[model samples]
Target: MGDTFEAVKEVIVEVMKIDGKDLSMETRFIEDLQADSMDQFFLIDGFCEKFDINISDEDARKIKNVKDAVEFIDKAKA
Candidate 1:
């Protein structure tokens, strides 16, 4: 995982109140994280702030897994 990926993991666990040991790159936000759209919104906001980047609503909607979110931010920066 990249730095962004690691940061995302920490944020997800902290914000979503999930067990770190239960989370993996493949874990689905809705299915595994049991997060609602509101949670997703907060996550996007927090992620962008933490990473000093911007994430559009459309881009945020495309996120499903941890890896997906990390890749989105990584690609945006690139």
Candidate 2:
């Protein structure tokens, strides 16, 4: 889960065009990171590519922050 969190963090940083130093588990994609809809889309795409899992739109909506994403991915992988 730690590795997955780091990987997700990397993907988020890449997609959001933000510095890795600015990231944290509680960082909200929209509120903290200033991510728009397209940024969200790309972030999901990055996650899917990295984890080899498909994230549904409904499921994606529940993932509002880095912690949410890592937890969701951990469950999916399990």
Candidate 3:
């Protein structure tokens, strides 16, 4: 999960253009990071590219926080 978290953090920091130091498992994309709908799409795309996994819109909607992203990727890889 640590590695997945780091990878997810990298994508969020890049897409959201924010400091990685402030990110955590509980960080919310919309509320905490101030990400808009487009930002959320790009974030999901970035994650797909980074992890080489296909995330459907249905699944993407369920990932509301850093922990969710990390856990999703970990499970997808498994």
Candidate that would win on lDDT: 3
Better of 2 and 3 by lDDT: 3
Cα-based lDDT at residue 37, candidate 2: 96
Please list the Cα RMSD from the true structure of every candidate, rounded to 1 decimal place. Answer: 1.2, 0.7, 0.5
Total clashing pairs in model 3:
0
Please give the CA lDDT of all the candidate structures.
0.84, 0.92, 0.96
Candidate 1 local distance difference test against the native: 0.84
Clashing pairs in model 3? Answer: none
Model 2 Cα shift for residue 50 (angstroms): 0.5
2-71, model 3: which lDDT tens digit per residue? 9999999999999998889989999999999989999999999999999999999999999999999999
Over 20-50, each residue of candidate 1 has an lDDT whose tens digit, in order, gives 8766779889888789988898888878987
Candidate 1 lDDT score at position 15: 83
lDDT of 2 by residue, 18-74 (tens): 788878889999999889999999999999999999999999999999999999999
lDDT (C-alpha) at residue 65 in model 1: 88
Q: Which residues of candidate 1, in runs, are more than 4 Å off?
A: none
